[model samples]
Target: MLERWSRGLKGLGNWTAGVMDAFYGALGTPGKYLQDFLNGSWLGHPLHPVLTDVVVGGFTMLIILDLVSLIFGANFRDPSLIILGLTTLAGIATILSGLTDFKDTATGDERNVTTLHGYTNVASILIYAIAFFVRLGGSETTGQILAIIGYLVISVGAFIGGHVVFKYGYMVNHNAFSRGRRAKEFTPIMPAVELAENTPTKAALGPTALVLVRRGDVVYALKETCSHAGGPLSEGQLQGGAIVCPWHASHFRLSDGAVVHGPAHTRQVAYRARIQAGQVEVEGPVG
Candidate 1:
């Protein structure tokens, strides 16, 4: 009964998210352009967090301002109600940006945590809306009381959001530590000497599949699993210095895992490789 009731309000978020999708969708190319912009192709990270921090941080400042007013009377005089208005607008924008990023995440533990975070934030939004309205009508003692409570709710929502990113690695696809050697410093069962020149060969490293490509003296190694949707990039066509995903045409530079093409903005987790004891060895950079 409680779980169902907890999820009961989720419809509000879904409805709000659907409305945002439609609004952004109607923008057509401009919408896609905004999505790419929010995806942080330029920043090399998801941008929702950046905007979210700004929104939440602004509200935090407002809370402090109110506290100061309550403590040091004259210095923080008449409540303008501007803070609540700005908070409402910024909160709504952050939710929209979060929804866009959330949609791209694949179904997994990360997605579940993200959904929870979103709903928590929605609850905070509701709490804030109520508080904002009360204050907007009249700055009563009860209004101040509600604002304090809303502040606490927002903090909890922020905590949940932090957990989704910091604890669960919501945006990160693969292990990026180990000196980039998890996929590189492997003792390949396939003979290195037998590898075809200027060609990518399939090799097994422990339980993971990898694509080993050589160009004269420099050998490039990356996970055969494409980070976007697990498409087989080993079977993908090689062009210039990148491997193009056959499924989505997402390209990753072999030298480093940087994506050189669209739809896939994340790196492929590159590895440093060498020939040791007549066998191919691969490893990645340490985190």
Candidate 2:
């Protein structure tokens, strides 16, 4: 049922893509920096969810305050209006940050889910904005009714947002399932002779995939999967000392797999690599 609804929303992606692209193009390099900040590149987690909490909490409190005013003869109008204003501001911030992150979603299904999630929140915020103005215009009962309606709309939006994250696994760290424990000793991956100089090559140790890059005598290794979106890092391009994910252009340092830029907040899992005998042996997360 929800899947059908999400699929129905897929057309929104096509309609909004050009608009988002225009917005992105206008911002350029500064916008990239702003996107990184909104994506939580500095915080090592998503910022959208955090801001959503503030909006949701504020609205919840507003509902409680309204209920108190209705039940008891208390005049909580001032506080209720204040909460509404703050929550609306937070909702706007949440929408901005969410759209920044949404611009990076690659797949149709993900975009479809996000389209519904985005518009639902937008609608909820609009309702709240209307309620705020209505209250300011001195209509207490009408404003309270609109506030209740806004809360209900936001609740539906919240549910859809959760579906995007939990069901679709959007914005999840791609490396979260891996234990992240370092190999106790060096394990041979492939013959050193096969590893081309300055090339991103894929190898594996048991179930874990690795990307190996050779620079002179040293070989740098990181998890083959991108932390942001499970993009194949071995298929990516090297820039200076970092490798750029081909899918979303996230840059991770080749030496330690530290995130140099994002859409990707968590660092890729790094490994220690050395040539032993005729084979390339890799171990550790390199501290």
Q: Model 1, range 28-62, lDDT digits (tens) per residue? A: 87776677666665566666778778778767776
lDDT of 2: 0.89
For residues 115-203, what per-residue lDDT tens digits would candidate 2 score against the true structure? Answer: 88899889999999999999999999999999889889899989988988998778899988883556889988899999999999998
Q: What is the C-alpha lDDT of each candidate?
A: 0.68, 0.89
The candidate 2 region of ten consecutive residues with least summed lDDT is 13-22
Predicted structure 1: lDDT: 0.68
Give me candidate 2's TM-score against the actual structure. 0.94
The most accurate candidate by TM-score is 2
Measured against the true structure, the TM-scores of the candidates, in listed sequence, are: 0.64, 0.94
